[model samples]
Target: MVDRKLFAGHAVRRMRRRAGLTQAAMAEALGVSASYLNLIERNQRPLTAGLMLRLAEVYDFDARTLSAGEPGGGADAIRRRLADPIFADLEIDRAELEEWLSGAPGGAEAFARAYDRGGAGTAASDAPDPGTVVRREIERWRNHFADLDTAAEGLADELRQQAGDLFGAMAERLRVKHQLSIRILPLEVLPDVRVRLDLHARQLQLSETLDPPSRVFALARQLALLEARGEIDALVRGGAFTDRAAERLYRRHLTGYYAAAVMMPYARFLRACEATGYDLELIRRRFGASAEQVAHRLTTLSRVGARGLPFLMLRTDRAGQVSKRFAGASGSPLVEGPGLCPLLDTFAVFQRPDERIVQLVELEDGSRWFTSSRCVGPAGGWSGAVRARFAVTLGLAAEAAGVLAAARGLDLTGGATPIGAGCRACTRADCPQRSAPPAGRTLLLNDRETGVSPFGFAGD
Candidate 1:
């Protein structure tokens, strides 16, 4: 087999510009001629192993940065975006996409942004969904904010929480520092509201209906708004959100992240995670947090140098409507798009309420994931009214299953249920649970014979 050449011209040029080095200066540092360096920077020449070693030695460069434009990275994102049905007629090949991504990454990113904004020709009245924009931004960062984690760790230390009584500590801090009194009002008084902050009265009112863990989360959210406002605002401003609604929504999300970080405090939580083998129930009890909160926090353990398992989380209601999703470092396509495979245990857990379901499933591409799903809260309220209940699923790559308690004593290789991203993106012809036909395929209507799948399509 021949060795593949490394061509990261854009990254090399960016690094040089960021270092404020002239072509000749950088070339001399890398022990290469200026003309050769220029050729490498222009993609006319590929960087050899020796040059790459020199780059690492001189600039402390990470070789993996060169793979950003490769198939499974940024180029993959462009490919997935172009896979949308709207671009079906374009028939843009991989070679063209790789060339575009390497040649003008900014233009490629702009194209992605346009696609995210519901296409370039979207009318003024047809504003892009604010929630979609915020979700994309969160996914772009892989739901991890290092600065927020640091600030929250500091705040958690300052709180001096004892026996994991974070709610009490936070309430005391609000009373002492912010001059905000905490009051638990009866459900009859605050029937519909769970938390109400009266600025004029200098009081934070929480409904008695909220469970202990939820109460702590609510208090932490309030404290985050008061204490981490600057950090949250900085993150929101950095988002460059054109829609004020999206900006506000993103601000709320950042505050929630900060709140979780404060409650779980990165170092302590990571230690607990490692020690417990990521047992969600045990960790929730230890931290005085809800199952959903624990699962969500698991996704945010993406700190540099000291990272935990790269987990992806998804929360959905009985109707299969997804309410929350975080892709984390794993970047599973299952968490992306509107559709989810009905066959995944995420939906099956709803059948067995309050019980944790662990399943090893293989996607269409043969990638396997170990998933744990359980039903989360529907906070107490008037008995006559409807309450919301959701199932939360936390999953990681199956290769790392050995590290998780949930995957213990399970067959990792065999007995893996074959799954797909969703009905539209899936090509599983024999899947009986398919709710819709795969996209870009002609429906096969056989009057005489019926297949296992209700909607048979003509394809491979």
Candidate 2:
């Protein structure tokens, strides 16, 4: 018999938590009741191989993680070991007993508890890569600025008036410093003339197909990196680093941040933003920037002492893939790392081209943010393809005041919904897509009926 007693419950619990499924949610997906799932999770029920396999399939966990025992201790040992933890009142002694319990639920829970408190910070170098850490750092800054947009507005106004030609001068340097070149061909030439980089020569060449306005932006992004490499490095130097791959990822991430900052140049952009009453379109026109570029730059207002209204900015295609995300005030709430917000109805907007303003949704642990979204694309001239297929939104807490409420326009606080990535850190009970219950909640069922959401918000 395989000793599958080592922390089977612990492993299951962890996987369930990470998957963001509540016991009821998991039970619904697994075709079982919440109580049965709770039994398996609490080490009260010995997990059968068939049931174990089912869990692995349903939750996307590796089979090895599901059957937790000492190295090579088969499934039975995993079960027995986990069951041993609840047998504290029982008394038995054997050489194998110690080995069996060593890898059991009690031990696994201890390790997890330690790790949660930051005691176990190291992971082996060969661990599978989680690609979003560096990306999340960028999102965090975007959120910071979004939260402070009002304050940053005052600063942006001052900088815009004062820093006339600084960006132009930087563009001039790109022409002189590296013999950089720009061209403007028809849109048909996009396939070949888009942009190319010659890393060895330290030169960036852009397609002649882009209009003069966009061409300037391409040039500016490249030049911005070259000019601000030092500042970029200084910012990412102290991050939680694991390997060279992470460092390089972070460096490229910083390049985009610097590029956006240079274009707006902080103080000037904030001043213009405020004077224009946070008019995103006006800023784009004045700066000759694309809507996406303008929104991105707007989110970077967190730098220096100035801040913006602190909004979350996301650009997604009709398909749910997120092309860009900027966090201006709060850090990204995603614990598993940043990706598309499932609730953001970007595709629907593409269907209704005339709806310039619509509400975007996000639900997490019961807190909902009602956001306004609009589409953007190249404006006028060079007709052939409709280049505008992007949406932009200004999100604020449904209950917030001033610009926040102004963006929503009507009072939407009545049923302020809950939306978020998941329960990894979510506190909402009314989320329909909730896959897991709140962290630390006991798996046992309570009498209260869960509302419409898959995971009912856990009562305080």
Candidate 3:
């Protein structure tokens, strides 16, 4: 297969500017002519693999940034936004949109921002939903924070040297460094909460109902708060959240990320994944983490040259409500929203809770992904309370399926299940699992015909 030439002139320019280098200086450093570098930066020439290597060697650039796709409101986002019925009459071609994005990305971003604001007439005070803002921020960074990972890895190393077990080490660190004692109380004592830090008592309280893995996670999160506060605060500040709620939510997420890193540790985890052919069960046992925790850690292995396959993850309850999603490097729209296709294996895994479901699915954009999902957690935990079950899914581009143990013995090509981003944005008119018609298409109703799909719509 031939490789696609990368046309990331905007990214190249951004890298140069961030390094405080002029075009001529950057070109000299890259061992290229000024004219050639100028063309490359102007999108007139594609960024070659050799030049990309030079950029990495000289300036310590991360090639994964280009693979993360366009930043924020770039071409892909603008195209998806244009799919709305409001722009149906425009008939914009894909190539034309790409050209426009490459030439004037700022203009494209402005248009996307305007559309997101419900057009230019909407009030400026109408801030975006805080959750949306936080999710976007996470996606902007591809759900990988290098500084946090580094800090957590260092702490993990120190903890390992201090004690044999991670949890014990984390607890001891908290007790010694922060004057905080660890206390596990019964669920009845802390009915609604799972973990809490009592500043006045100088104790970290955890509910006894939590399993061993969860207790370790709780301890690690507190350790993150005590040891990695500077790193977490820096990341939250860098997010520039306009809403206090979003900032707080993002900080919590950062701390959780740190805890996961401290538990798994980047270099060791990546080595284990590669050795195990990306086996989740084995890795989970090795790290003493739960299935969901192992999956979440897989998404954060985006550390420059030692990067793992870029996977996206989604968590959904039995009711089909998506609670969490991380886009990683895939940047596929399927994981970006709650309204995902019902035909996905993530929903199917609920039927056979004990088994993991792995399938090759093709999206409407002609991209194929290898997905594996399994049911996790009975949040009530045998207490006879409301038992909420959720499915956790991890997916990456199909090309990398061979590296995954779950995809073993499966055909990578052909026989892929055709799926959509969601019912609203999905253009698949014949999918029986579609709950609603696509947004921009006209609904077709005929008394003489009763098709497989509940709602039929006109094709684009």
Q: Which candidate comes out best when scored by TM-score?
A: 3
Model 1 C-alpha RMSD vs. true structure (Å) is 5.0
How large an RMSD does model 3 have?
3.4
lDDT of 2 by residue, 56-126 (tens): 67767656433322222232222223232233224344434434443364653443333222244555553
Model 1 TM-score, 2 decimals: 0.85
Task: Encode model 3's per-residue lDDT on 1-460: one tens digit a residue.
Answer: 1133567777888788898999999999889999998888777788887888988899886676674445444454555566655675688987888777777767775675555444456565664566666776676577888888989899899989998998888888888888999999887888888788899999999887888889999998888887788988987887766568889989989999999999999999999999999999999999999999999998887775677878889999988888888877665667754387877889888789999999889988799999999999833254577777899999988887787888888989878889987787787777888888877788999899899899988887
Clashing pairs in 1: none
Q: Using lDDT as the measure, which candidate wins?
A: 3
lDDT to native, each model: 0.80, 0.52, 0.80
Q: Would you estimate the TM-scores of all the predictions?
A: 0.85, 0.55, 0.88
Q: Residue by residue across 254-336, what tens digits does model 1's lDDT show?
A: 98898898889999999998898888889988888888889889887766457788898999988888888887766676786
